[model samples]
Target: MLTRKQHELIRFIQTRLEESGVSPSFEEMKEALDLKSKSGVHRLISALEERGFIRRLPNRARALEVLKQPEDISAGKTAVRAAANSNTALTALKPALAAPREPANDVIELPLHGRIAAGVPIEALEGQATLPVPAALLGPGEHYALEVSGDSMIEAGILDGDFALIRRTNTARDGEIVVALVRGEEATLKYLRHEKGMVWLDPANSAYEPQIYRDSEVEVQGKLAGLLRRYH
Candidate 1:
């Protein structure tokens, strides 16, 4: 089995490839892995390649191609030839860890704009608000952005200063964090619970009570895809 450092390196490489559509440079690897120097990354990379977990092309920049994911080789099967593409390589080397075969989903790059208050209506302000999140995170509904207003969601781990990713909808799955426009005038963040003809916006912390709403009064903005926290 590969050591923890190797595992981390594999994951880092995989993420970089997915993001950039190519392998990272040795310098990038060194920075991402926090190695002392480029040579350190090269040594680990060579070790991985020797183990049949990766492939490298001579004299090519970003030449390292991950041939075996941790799960693939972990099953002890690096002997057989698999398909010739990166996806196949991942599956051949680690079938158990293979990601689902799905089409590319849309991911929005949201900026980390300013904050809003839960207790009062405030003017919306825009600043550096760029955060990339998968389209799947947005519920099957319309798209919208909400300026977080208060600390009500804080006890629930939704901070007051965070930008909440919101999708516009009226229906929400149970236990999903949602942006709900309550009473047509105010918005709040809470977990959704649909039952007994009533929808409940449950808070992550016990300090706040669940916001109950009727089918008509609740405006499901969208499932909270995710949040971006910024400090300046």
Candidate 2:
């Protein structure tokens, strides 16, 4: 069974990987969560792997693959809670309500600054690295990272697993790749073009049709500035 700390750590790692496509290093995890030492963080990670929540590769940095899919993380949480209750060692854990996290709007606050897409939930204070970006990279507003989930932007060379750097804005210029929120909790990556009172979500890929919507139902989350790809 996992302890409360272990469960929180698991969720953190999972969310970080989804946002950045890589797991945090032990030292980073230690600093992020305020652990006593890197070794202590390592122990918790090892325990998580042993319990089937994660799979670790020997000597590989950020090689931890969460065994459960991101969409099914709620189930994982329930399982971890059950496991904790069954273990006598975890009985001492009092529910530590998570501290109120800061909003990601502040520039000084840690930026979840890579691969940001429109409407993706990126909690502030979650990113580890202090981004040392060139002045050219900074836009007027804050940005976030979003892992490209589908191949809808293939014509734009925005493949799956690629990271889109998005500047937060509700307005976009024509021919720009914007993270758009469609009706029904559906977010998509597409080129935004204004036509009369309606907006058209044009995909670069020829196979997909351009989505048309009224301004009220569709929201422009941000405009894509660039992409970052990591090769393993």
Candidate 3:
């Protein structure tokens, strides 16, 4: 059985990795959890590592890998369920709750294009399927989904195996996350930075370096609208 803090830390790490293809930095972990020092982050990471929940890659920065799947952790909730059940009898006298809500009609179906690299530009491929998403999340305009395939944008909460919803457009504002085709060769999902006659694809993870290109050599495919994740 894990302590409350341990469980919270594990969940935080899992969420961070899921949202961004990379593990959270120690400072990030500390700040998120409101820990007093970096030593607290180290101790928690060590505990999780010893329990086979995560692994630290050798000779790499911010290279922690999740060993235990989210499903496995969720399966350990028997105790929590039992505690909830214990309160059922006490609340039984309360009025019954309202009926279950029906599915909303605001769900929009979008094409799921094959994987796109978050770490580096890769050739864009035809979509393999379609997925349903909330229309409010996508806003207006033509949109599509692409599965993220790298940890380069982990710090930005875009993770491997996550679906990034992109609005189809040839233009994007500076500092926005966008799918950029470099030299008409491949498309990469990254934060766009514009300088004098130059465009830079910036990764959110420290382990990877930013890519610089001439403004004329890059084409904007789409701007990121939202993200989706399914834990199994």
Candidate 4:
């Protein structure tokens, strides 16, 4: 059986990976677990890893993947054990067998294409990396991730260095933030607006001017779905 702190840390890590596509940093884990120092968190994580509960991704910063959860003998299994076991042992296992099992959660890896500019239009680089996202973060559609490179969408709560989750779509509604490819060469993250046969890319921050283009100059690549931020 795992220690209390080990169980708590594993659950916390799983919750964080499921909620946000990123693992909690040492500082965040320390603060959440009420530990005095990061070394305590490290020891707990090491114990969990040694027990086959989680594994760290190689060459990735703060990347942790949960392998399996703590196992519990189900009521049916307990019943089978009772057939050949003593009444005292069956009675001892009754409480555990009565508890409901928690549903399994999943993590999804999204294609980490590259960075998209949130300020001025920049060349969207294509890469072969992937981001481990929670299945809960995406809906019924293909998805990808782009690291935000500028602060043009800061007012929209999208900040620089935040991972922008993109739901693959060639269409978007008016005033929705989208990944728009400009002239088939560069891509940008901005609000999409169509007016009188012209396409306008509006920024959330007033410091930047709106970019206007001909309808033929822009193509909708995807819609902004969510964001993941890492603590530095």
Give the alpha-carbon lDDT of every model: 0.56, 0.57, 0.69, 0.72
**Model 2 lDDT tens row, 25-131:** 78878987789998888888888877787777444345565654333344322111111112211100111122113322222322443333322322221244443
Residue 227, candidate 4: Cα error in Å is: 0.8
Could you estimate the TM-score for every candidate?
0.45, 0.43, 0.56, 0.56
The residue-by-residue lDDT of candidate 1 on 1-232, one tens digit each, is 8877788787787665433224677787888888899988878887888898888744434545566678843352221222222332211111112332322244555454445444333444346655454443333444555557776655433556555655556666786666666766555667778879997777655566777779788776555643444434
The model with the greater TM-score, 2 or 4, is 4
Q: What lDDT, from 0 to 1, does candidate 3 have? A: 0.69
After aligning candidate 4 to the native by TM-score, how far in Å is the CA of 186 from where it should be?
0.2
Query: How high a TM-score does candidate 2 get?
Result: 0.43
Error of 4 at 89 (Å): 42
Give one digit per residue, the lDDT tens place, for model 4 in 1-232: 9888887787787666544435788999999899999999989988888987778755556777666667641222111111111222211111111222321134576888888999999986488998765454345578898988999987665678877878899999887789999999999999999988999999978899999999999999998766766544
